[model samples]
Target: MTDGPATRYARAARTWAPIDWWKLEARAVYERPELRRALAPFAPVEAWRDLAKDVATAWGILLTLSHIAALTLPVLAGGMLLGWLFQRDDLAPVGLTGLLAGIGAVLAGIGLVTEAREPTGTDPRIGRLIGGLHLVPSTLGLLVATLAISLGSADAPLGVVAFIVDVGVGIAYFVLNRGPADSGSDRGRRNLARLERALGELPPTDRARMEADAREAIDVLELRDLVGADDAARAREQRLGLLAMEMAPRTDLATQRR
Candidate 1:
């Protein structure tokens, strides 16, 4: 009696296959320089460069929550400082009120910036306008900090320090979101390494079939940037693994009919 397709696939997967990685590595070592030289001409037009840009953009968009948190903390701290300034019994009401107003403007400006960058379906023009309003907070924070220092309020300085730290964090966050230019390449290498390890164990036909199936799924998932470097290979492997479960029952039904 002939085995079913699933049985055949399983048997193919368990069959011994000899692949000499050490020899491949040794060959690569010997030919590394020449191979690099041969490929140098195409380096300028590598497809990975464009892929890297898309990956970075996707990474940035995914980290919007982090960006919002980073920006929000400073605004909150500034609000507290303004509250302290107005509550001060020692300082004259007029000067303290003026300082409070300045802080208000700073908070409002940052709020606008936050709203602009908020992940929502808002009017693009309005978002741009709000984003442009960030200069208001940037300039206001400095001025208000300077004023607070001059006013002899310790709270204002602390608030300004938090604001500065938040700004620094914001910059770092942006850098991270942009990711390194080589990020996509690094991710690709890791994915390829993982897939090679996984499919290498399977027979050639099974391996090829799995690769084709997984590639289609990966393309669909990656469109929303869901499958990124972090655990993407594992996720792909899991998805492919699930395909066996999906097929197993169908195979059993076919066997019953036979």
Candidate 2:
């Protein structure tokens, strides 16, 4: 007999009604040697494993670039203004410093935009590089401004005040934009938790992939009952049903109420 929509629907309904059906399918996919071998070619073990890591890395890079750009613009602008105010006979060095810093800031802004568009990854090394880049420029700008105030033959108190303001602004920018570092274990745990939540929201037929992801996540979290107990399972199924109902073509609810 040909399998039609009715047969598929019946199978889905039966599968959805029992958690054991889902669990058995999951076990079969992993434990059955023939099924595993047949599925090996289509499995995206690396891509699925690396998805969270990529996202975290991308976020870290974007934030770092943004924070650096914020600090860079103000420092460059203020430095140029200060240099203009002090217009000594030798304006070359100060002018060049301001110009170079301004260019660097613009380049950093471009980098930020590019990084924002790129896909994220979960590499700690990449995150560290991004984080370091964010802090390095601002720190250097602060130091340079401080040195200029101390060494320059300008209005001493005014120079000091400007330097302090510039440093303060940079510090504030860093504080506001900095994101937490991604530890390898923590990233894995968070990704797993997210996968579990996503799996819990899917219908039985549509949930096979999500269930696999949830299993991987559970393994990462070392949780025995990531999907919880009978009550939790029922609640999850109800939630999925409600979601499906909402997605279905709408009829007049008022007529039904009557």
Candidate 3:
């Protein structure tokens, strides 16, 4: 029999993707203690491998959103205008591809915003599962752009580059949301070796900043200190808080919830 999807997806998630400029950009979000201090966990740099994946996952969010805006506005407004002015209903939607792109772009924006919101709830695992679902249309417009390019083939120069970036992001989300079974309890503790490698790749100051962020994320979110807390209740607060930070981001929930 063929390998199960879990086995396969876990393998694919482990596979090093062909393009990774996004990982660098995501990591840069943590370059300074000033920036790190402002993060969801007070310093979410402490989360485990999956949350680590969250680091890589945010790369194309802004670019993808901007890319969709660039493509959609021109085609949507221009196409409608051309269709109306020339009295050719036939011109509307370029036979429906433009319409699909427009719809997908709007839905994709909503999905991406959901993906960006940090989880705030009694159980973060549930929030992560929901937030992960949002990554789809979050990346949908880019996929539509890829499809639009494939269907049109005339916009090759920029479209080709977007196609590659889209593929890289696809790889990222697959790894992030579809990996092997996870309790997500291992946020900071689950993937120590990989985190170490990532840490090793950083400059000395950047590495120092991560350490600082871990300490700060707890305070920023009003979580008790996990290691130093004297009792179970405080440690539970830290545990839940880190899980909440790892799961999602949106609308400065980071500042308001705490």
Best by TM-score: 2
TM-scores vs. true structure, each candidate: 0.29, 0.32, 0.26
Decoy 3 TM-score against native: 0.26
- Report the Cα lDDT for candidate 1: 0.35
Q: Kindly report which residue stretches of model 1 are placed more than 4 angstroms away from their true locations once superposed.
A: 1-65, 79-139, 172-209, 212-258
Ranking by lDDT: 2, 1, 3
Per-candidate clashes, comma-separated: 0, 6, 13
Candidate 3 or 2, higher TM-score: 2
Candidate 3 lDDT over residue span 1-258, tens digit each: 223221222233332221111122233333332222223232233222222343433433653453455344434533443443346332223324334434434544444344444221112343333333333332443444444445553233243333233334434434434432222333222232333344345566654444344334323223322223332234234322232333332222223222
lDDT, candidate 2, 1-258, per-residue tens: 323322233233422323332332233233223222222111223322222222334445655555555545545645554554466554224334444444445545554444334322224344344434434543554455555555663333233333343344334334433444221243334433443444454456644543444333323222343334553443334321122122221231211100
For each candidate in the order shown, give its overall lDDT on alpha carbons: 0.35, 0.37, 0.34
Which sections of candidate 3 miss by over 4 Å?
A: 1-194, 202-258
Residue 1 of candidate 3: its Cα lDDT? 22
For candidate 1, the 10 contiguous residues with the lowest summed lDDT are 17-26
Local error of candidate 2 at residue 232 (angstroms): 32
Per-residue lDDT of 250 in model 2? 20
Candidate number with greatest lDDT: 2
